[model samples]
Structure formats: structure tokens, C-alpha cells
Target: MARIQLNNIQKRWGAIWGVRDVNLDIADEEFVVFLGPSGCGKTTTMRMIAGLEEPSEGEIVMDSEVMNEIDARDRDVAMVFQGYALYPNMTIYENIRFPLRMRGVPKEQHDTLIKRAAGLVELTDYLDRKPSALSGGQRQRAALARAIVRQPHVFLMDEPLSNLDAKLRQHMRVQIKHIQRELKITTVYVTHDQIEAMTLADRIVIMDKGAIQQIGTPDEIYNDPANTFVANFIGAPPMNLIAGVMEQGTFTAPGVRVDGLPAKHDGKVTLGVRPEDCTVTADGGHLSGSVYGVEPTGDMTYLTIKVGDKLIEVKAHRDYRADLNSDASVGFDPKRIYIFDTASGQRLR
Candidate 1:
């Protein structure tokens, strides 16, 4: 296992910068995930670490050794792509054994290592089947087995589960987490899927437009986002942001009001509240609006309220009322509120 550090790393495509001044310190045996939307420089950052693409500037240090000039083959890092990247004609056992063979392991040892990896990935039964004969999930498991058989110091995965169906993705998530924990190899997985990052990562690095936005544990990023972008990006249904001014210890909006906001913020501010934070009240609430829509998710119901030009989503245990066009007052606790600077989108406190 190894620790990875990227110092002032940069990647440029002619005049356009792909990834700029990116610095991250990943500890040994830590499972760190790089998460962001597409074209957000996540893949560029990973490629630089793998030496698949050299940085325009900066250094990559692994296990305390600077690897700026190291070739990918010499870096002792293995990468699993979105596609399984297995040889179609090669049987699963052969595919798993290929890396060991290339590394010049003895033929006798290949069986033991390959069998162990296949067993770990639950592919012992399908070891003789070719990639074309396997299901998508099975093929992915084979790919994972191949990566692990080599026992590289650092494992870099670029959306390795993107090709699977929803159900398979969910199952593979648990499997991947189990394997990562069992092996204790340093891993950096890049994905745009927030659920994947939240479930699998020890810590998450959120990026956008080639810049680092925030890096923290899943709870830290979800509960206390560093800025407006992180706040909006990390949550499902996102956070509701209301533009208003803080005056007289309250936040005044077009057709809504949040009480006791001035204690934490002043001047122009954006008030943030998650769907789960807002409540429907019959009376004595902070704001009132008509229900725009209702979404049911079996365990919880999400209600979107239309207040002038703004729409706020509230999460409730169940569908509160039978009618859809009802008006309701919604209230938010002051402690659950988030205040941000309108101009800079930075957190207030």
C-alpha cells in the first residue's frame, strides 16, 4: 500500500487548462474518491497520477518517492477503467493470471494467486469462461480480480461500475467496499455518482471546472459544505436556496420569511435548507406557500412548494394530505439553516 500526494498539479490542453493547481494528500491504505460532474478534470487528475498523462507542471509523490518521470508500468499502480478492459478471447482464469504472468511470476504460483483472487471476487466457478460469456457484473468482477491479482500499491478506478445496471451497481458497491477494506490498498476512485462516493469513500474530493471545491468525509461534505456549490452538489433534491436580505434579525424574501437569521448573517444572503430540514405546519410557521408537486419515495415524501418565483422542497415521513393543491406553512429550525454570501457563494459561519 502507498500514500499519494499531488502537489500543485496542472494539466493543460494547449491554452485551456484541464486541471489546475490541484493538491491532495491521500494517506496510506485510505480509500479516497474523486467525485464530480463530467469534464470536471477528475479523470485528468487520475491520469496524471497513473502517468497515463503527464502533468504540464507539478509532482506526484507515492510512498514518499517523487514520480514525475516514472512511466505508468514502473509506477506500481493499477487502473481499472469504466469498461472492464478484459481480453475478450481470454478465459477469466487466464485474464486474472495475465498480470502475474507478465510480471514473470512462476507458473506454479499463478494458480494459487489466480485462484485466491477469483475466490475473493466470487468468480471461482466462472474462471474458465471467456469475457464474452460472462454477464456485465461478472465481467467487472473478473476485471477487479485481474487488478487485485497483481497486488499493486495503489488502485485507481475511473467509474469502474458505470457500465452496470442499477441493481448490479448497488451489489457491486458492497462488494467493492468489502474488497477495499480487506486488502487495505490505497485506492482513488473517480466517479460522478454521489451515492458511490458517499458509500465507498473514507474521504471524498469534490471538484468542478478543473478546481478542487471541497474535500472531506461524506458527512462533512453533506452536513457542512464548504460553499454554495458543495452544498448544492452533494445532496439529493439539492438544498433549497432563497435569495433575501437579512434585516431586523430575520430574513425577508419575496413571499417567504425565515425568522432569526440575522443572528448569524447580515446584508444580502442566501438561505439554504435541505428538504429534510423543512417542515409542514398547520399554523405558527415561518413561511407559507402552495404545494407545486409531491414525490413519493416509499419511506418518505418530498413536497415542492411554490412561493412567488422560488420553489422549496420539504421532506416528510408520508404524504401528509390527500389533496395536491393545498397550501401549507413550512418552518425551519435556525440551527439547521445555512447562510451564504450571495456574491461570492461562500459560507457565512
Candidate 2:
């Protein structure tokens, strides 16, 4: 419904910067997610776009119109909060129709609007039910339906799925993705959940401490992180960060030696290896450590190794689950290794 452009967007809370120098272009009908850890300014950035919070600097334009002077209600955006925010006394029908009614849409149009929204979210079954009678997933759907009925130019969601249990959250995510795709409305979602960001977003904006760290597709973020923070933040079990000194093209850590692969640093540098990228070797690997434990996650197994004082974790397929408690040799793929400046935490090619 709208293409969003933010240029040098800044939000300052007194001396503290909530977000700074953020420039992003979100295509019309694209699903974009602002993702990072808590206090990373994701929500603040979303609020600025929604006009709920004013930016200290920069420009926000929606569908070619500058929005600096526009109020939140006039911005034609609908926001879904994490709390659901459903009216306890209102039935599902009333809740869904509340937005349209507030705008005094014709009485004849309310039923058609409500039905279409309920159908999109598959909440027609519970239209007569109160918020008290609905399940967590159902309640979330009701809230989503309410947002849809308004037909806003852009949709803003701030961790809307965080409160649900694991199973329901997964189901709801699929449903939300489907609904968003079908409607083709511009959407901005904010969450710290990497899985949610990967699955739902067409492009993900990774933020940290009020600055935009990286913005890319899921594969781009996962396979090629911009810096150490992004490498550590986006993974499920997370990437292993080991401190090592590069000497004569060999990397040596306190307890492990990574041979063959060379580095350009005589000074200490941090090496990052994704769990899945670490391979188990029979004869000799780059590093050897005592097996701390094994975590079986249905299809894949995670092996935690104790190398001197440091713990390294690696992911192996189900076949390696039997190697638990045994001594292990690990090797990182050369192409998969990420090197970061020890002092700056910036990526070093």
C-alpha cells in the first residue's frame, strides 16, 4: 500500500540516542523487520515511522509524501502491540470493527469489512466470542483482524507474537506471513527473535545500541554478517567466538590450534565459527578438546567441548549423537570462518 523511505532518521532521548543516522527504503507491500536484542532501538525506530514518537532529526516519507508534519492517526498506519490490547468487554466482531467505526465508516460497509478481515485471519469462527473466551492464538488473530479491517497504508507490529507459547507462536507466524503476503500491505515488524525475523521479513534490519548495524536478507545476514555483533546475535545457538593470536599465518588460541588457514595478524584477533560449520574429524582436526556434553535437538546434535578454560560448541548431524562424552577433534571451514578486530569488534574481511 505504501513505500517507506527513512533518511538519516534520528531519535534522541535527551543525551541518549534511541536511533541515529538510519536510512532505509522499504518497498511497497514489502515485509521489513527491525531486529536486534533489547534496547537496540528497534521499537523506537518503528514508533518514529508510525509517528507515535517524533524523530530528533531526519526525514520520513511514505508513498512519496513527507510525514514530518503528519500525526499518527493521519499517517494511515495500524499498529499491533505485544499485549494484544483487545477490548475485554467487546466481542470479537466489535473488536475487529472498532477501527472502522471510530472513523465513522458507513453502517452498510462494516459487515463486509469485518467479514473480510475475519476471513483473512481465519477468525470468523470466533467472531461472536469475547476476548476472555479466545485462546492466545485466537486473541492475537482478533487483534490482527482489527488491524486489517482498517486497511491502513502500513502495518506496524512490535513483537506481537512474544507472549504466545512456542507451538502457537510458530503456527501464528506462518499464518501472519501468509496473510501479509496475500494482502501485500507494507509492514514493519520489530522483534529480537532471529527466527521470526528470518521467516517473516523480506529484508531484515539488524540494529544495536541505537545504530543500524546491518540490513539484508536472511541468507545474507546468516552467511555474511557485517560485524562480530551481527555474527553473535543472529544465530540460534550462536556462533563460537574464540580469542586467538595469528602468528606466521597460523592461528593459536590458549587451548586450541587452527592450522592450515592463515591470518594476516600478529596481534590478537577474534575468530567466529558457526556451530554447523565445525566438522568432526577422525584423524586430526584443527582443534582438540574434551567433550563437555551433547544436546540432541531431534535432527541435529550440539556438542559442547571444553578446550582448556574455554567452551566451544559445534553442531553435527544426528549420526554424531553417539559421540557424546568422547574426546573430539574439530575443524572450521576456511570459507566459513569470520575474523574480527579484537579491540574494535569490526569484521576484518
Candidate 3:
């Protein structure tokens, strides 16, 4: 049972800081994801936890023991990277058995452990094939089987599925989820993909500029964002934000007037509304504009409307279609609107 805790974590190089003031607690068997764009310090935090990189300031505790001075080999953590990292000369069976051999497990048990691990990942038939003979997906499964063979207390996976194509990625995502649930080990996964984070994590820790932006369940993160950054980051076509003025709970801008907001302040603000929350209207809605672009994404169509100088996307029915530059209108419930301070980017609760 590994319950990991990080306190006041910080990492720096000379004067440039890579991570800053990160504090998180991972319950035993909890699957947490560190999600962000590139250069956001997600990978750095994971490395520090793995004992690959030491934090300049902080304490890492695993199962009530301090790990700052401990060697990575003693951490009882398994890591699966984006690359296969398999030995070309070794068969998949030998590759999966490498960890057990290095850990000094009895030679009599190697066959049983290797077979169980390979079977879990559906790589049982490919055990005799070398890494070079396997496809990319098969190679990744070999890496996963290697990690699983260790039966470690924690698993650290960094972008493990990013190397696969879309279809393979989707398949691997399902397999990973099933494996994690079956093993029930404390797992920390790092990825820049929101879909992966949303689908896999029990909770998500979103980071930006070397700092944590927010930590919550996927439902909370998607429906209730903390600020403008989170509002724009989590969705496929993120929330639409229009710069305007908010006075007496009414937001007004050129070609947009969304009234009955919840804010009491009066100043420059940004109005945010999700595309799915909007509906196409024959009557001139609170917001109307010309169709700037139309894109059909199989199940639904996305309409880009030019509201004055700002472009906002609205989710329409799959059958909806209109000529470019045609007049269109969109309406949303007042309760669904999100208000943020334009200058500070903070939500106006």
C-alpha cells in the first residue's frame, strides 16, 4: 500500500524555477494524473517522485517514510515511458522477466510471473518474438507487462500512449484503465492530452507555468473551472470568452448582451459560455452574428460565429448546415454563463 504525499515541492536550475510550491496527497490505489501543456513542469514533478530528480525544497513521503535520501531502485515504483525501451536482442518473455531477475526473485518463479504479466496485457502469444518484431502497440504492451511483473506499490507512467496512432491510442487507453483497476496500485500518470486525463484519472491535477492550476475530479474540472486558463484548457472546443463590461449583473459588448449574470461588480470582464450549452435560434437571440466557419465532426457540427470581431463556436445538430457568411443567432441560459475578470482572469463568483 503506497500513499504518496508531496509537501512544498520546488525545483530550480540556477535562477530559473522548473516547479514551485506543489503540495498533493495520493491515497492508496488512487489513480491521479498530472496534466498540462508542454513546459508546465508535470514531468519534472513525476521525476522528483521517482527519485530520478531531487526537489530543491520539499519532502516526499511514501507510506509514512521520507524518500528524499532513498535511491530510485529502493522506491518500489515501476515506470512505463512513451518509448518502448525494450532490448532488441531480447525476446518479449525475457524482457518482462528482466525486473524479476534484477530483484533477485527465485529463478523457479520466473516462468509463472512472466506468464501472468504477459497474459494480463494480451501479449502471451508474442512472448517468443523480439522487440523489433513486434508492432508499436505490442512493444508498448511489453513495457507495461515488464512493469506489471514487478508488482510494485506504485506505477509512474509518462505519456505511455502518446506514441500510438489514434485507434491504437484508444485501444491502449481502455487496456490501461482495465489493468489499473485490476491491479489497484497507486498510479501517477502524466500527459498533455485532456482526453486521456479525463478518461483515466480518478482525479486530475492541472499544472501550468510550473504551478498547479487546480485539482479535482473530471466532472468538477469540466463543469466548474477555476479561472480563464482552466476554462480554456479542458474542452475540445473550450469555453467561449468575450471581452466586455459587466454592470448591474449584465454583460454588454459589441454584438453581445448576456443579461442576468451573477456578478455584483461593474468593470471590464469576460463572458464565457460553452458551445454545447448554446442553441441555434430563429428569433434573434441575445447574441447574433454571421457564420464565420462550419465544421462537421461526425456526431455534431461546430458553427463558428463572428460576433463583432470575436469568434465563438456553437455546437449544432449534425444535420445543421448553413452557407458561410450567413446570419445566425445563438441563445444560452443565464445560469450557464461564466463570468471572469478581464484583467486578472479570475472567476467573478
Candidate with best TM-score: 3
Q: Which of candidates 2 and 3 reaches a greater TM-score?
A: 3
Q: Model 2 misses residue 303 by how many Å? A: 0.6
How well is each residue in 221-261 modelled by candidate 3, as lDDT tens digits?
A: 88888888888999989999899998887889998888777
Off by over 4 Å in 3: none
Model 2, global lDDT: 0.89
The model with the greatest lDDT is 3
Query: Which scores higher on lDDT, 1 or 3?
Result: 3
Worst 10 residues of 1 by lDDT: 319-328
TM-score of 1: 0.97
Mark the regions of model 2 whose C-alpha exceeds 4 Å error after superposition. Answer: 260-266, 321-326
Q: For every model in order, what is the number of clashing pairs?
A: 0, 0, 0
Q: Which residue pairs in model 2 clash with each other?
A: none
Q: How far out, in Å, is residue 246 in model 2? A: 2.0
Better of 2 and 3 by lDDT: 3
For 263-292, candidate 1 gives per-residue lDDT tens digits of 747789988988888888886677787888
Q: Roughly what TM-score does model 2 have, to 2 decimal places? A: 0.95
